[model samples]
Target: MASAPHSPLPVQLTTARPTVDGDHTGTHLGRAARRGELVRLHRGIYTDAERWSDAPPWERSTIATVAAAHRSPPPVFCRESALLLHGVSLLEPPRDVTVRTRRSPEAGVRRPAATFRRDVPPPHPLRHHEAPLPAGMSRPERRDALIRGDRGLEQTVLPPDAVPWCPGPEEGLRVEPLPLALLDTIPRMSRPAAVAALDSVARGSRLVDGPVGEEDLLAWDGFLRTKKARRRWESCWAFADADAESVGESVSRVLMDQWGLEPPQLQVRFVVDVDGGSRVRVDFHWPERGIVGEFDGLAKYQKPELLAGRRPEDVVVEEKLREDALRRLGLRVVRWVWADLRHPTRLRDMLLAVGVPFRG
Candidate 1:
């Protein structure tokens, strides 16, 4: 109901068998789809009428496909096949199914609506998936079986030895380890996908219930810092002390506190001269002194690529213009740079000289 019941435990390799049961008529299936009772994913893969109350079925199936591959190994789903199996996020959603596997199956194996990819392991195969299955071939044996007829137990990953990386549900067709999944996906996955995975397992909430091992998650922080690709996620870094709603604001808040200035109400808004229809949103506000501190970052005045395209003179001129405008409205404006945050105490003294008391 919530998720396609975890692939029936001990499920068999269904490659040579019918994916869907032979029970009811196609008409009943058609009616359900028409009534939105059964949402058809791809073709024969159908999910309950009601999707996961939250995420789409694709995400659920990503888990399921991986399960299927595990239930029946010797055909490690990979590449596009692997992508299809894991529900890896793609821009236009891939048409050709990809997978990474050392060997290819029969020559003319045909899929109903998707093309199966045959991948040779890259030096670093994305072989991060693995899990041990129950030791049996019973009614639900198919859920964790490897070969046809549920013959033997073959691990799912192409190189089963590289089990530390893959994320799956269990030992046999099990879900990959959530942390390893996050790490494996970080370099290759889009920010949203990678972020989603990280958010799912790495959130403060999950950490509470997690069985934390001796491994230090923060060790990866240094590597993430040097990425230079997208630093916005740094907001979640263990050292990022601010709780700004967005990463930019988070960085700004961290700097403000580091500088020892009394923290300001973020996104502060106050109406200005009514007739002038003036209004301002201060990045930080010294409410007691009516002094506003704005943290300037490239995203606002300059695009990320150009870093600081504004001339130093232009920056000074703009700051002056803004200061004048705020002063006209009876508000004093102060600015902070990225460097100031490194020595927030110095900035704090400056604020104190300007009549803003420091609790220090």
Candidate 2:
């Protein structure tokens, strides 16, 4: 009666063992492709049509990147390509694939959907250098000279242990390790996006709905030394909350920080007397100001999994009631949707209108 929902999981051509090893006359493979039973991800990459159709843009790009990396004499997938492989979301996807090549490509050499760059290795801590002597060269001047001379060697290198191996039916694909990958990625992203990526990587326990343990905190802190931008990393880590439940919420928090607003308590639970007693969790709460903020993402109402057997209408009704119950306790409830996030100034103004104060 109705078509099946598309699956988000990626399907590799290697998984199509029958078609991969079966025919060469363009008979079976062509039929499958024509029938929409298979979708080509790249030149030699294919996935189940339904799965490819269902995946989001980022997911498809990620799959394609993986496929490209598996080609003969595999290119070192780096930068945004590596970020995708490591499961970090980007504010914007790269227009062309990025990879590390052994040497710089011929001048003006370009692929329609791929870009290449030469790799830089970590700088040696101690290296001899010669620089033109300035009259009365002070210690600071000498130090600057050394830094400039050793700049090339100061580049961070991916640790041998940190490379990620993505297994597929054909074999496995190698990617930069999470820590080094973040180093390359963070420098290319805005502060807020970088913070979100760091939070995601350090979020193993949160994914399981467990407490954010010291091990998780220490691991994230330790990884900071593997790259440059220690101060930026520290700023990101300082604002990071393993408790942030979604990307939108994480971005909202970063925006608040950028706007100099007081940080809201995340996912705070409230015990309501309504219906004899009920517990409700809000996305953000400013306890001192008696305010609660909710990021009304569409998925909460529209996604079947999130709806928990309830209709969209039922979710709307339930939320209205929850807001009313919250309001009854002298708490002001405010809500913003994805649209507000796009125009963040409007979101900030809305919160301020409700008496949310700036951080002093």
lDDT scores in order: 0.40, 0.59
Candidate 2: tens digits of C-alpha lDDT, residues 1-360: 011122244345532233455655335545565565665444444556665555555555555566565456555555666665555545554445555433222112234211121121111111112221223555356456556664211122222222223233233445544455555457557876777666665564322122334453454344344345567766776777777766677788888888999989989999887679999999999999999999887667756787888999998998999999999989999998878888899999999999898997
lDDT of 1 by residue, 1-360 (tens): 111121222211111223366654545555655665554333433344333223334344343343344433424443333433333322222233333222224222234322121221101112322222222323244333433444432213333212222243343332233233333335555433333333333323323224222274343333232344225444333333222323334444544454565666667776654336566667677787888766654444443233366665676675566567777878877776545544656555656666654545
List RMSD in Å for every model shown.
16.4, 10.6
Candidate 2 segments whose C-alpha is farther than 4 A from its true place: 1-40, 47-55, 92-96, 106-167, 205-228
Give candidate 1's TM-score: 0.32
TM-score of each: 0.32, 0.68
Q: Which candidate wins on lDDT?
A: 2
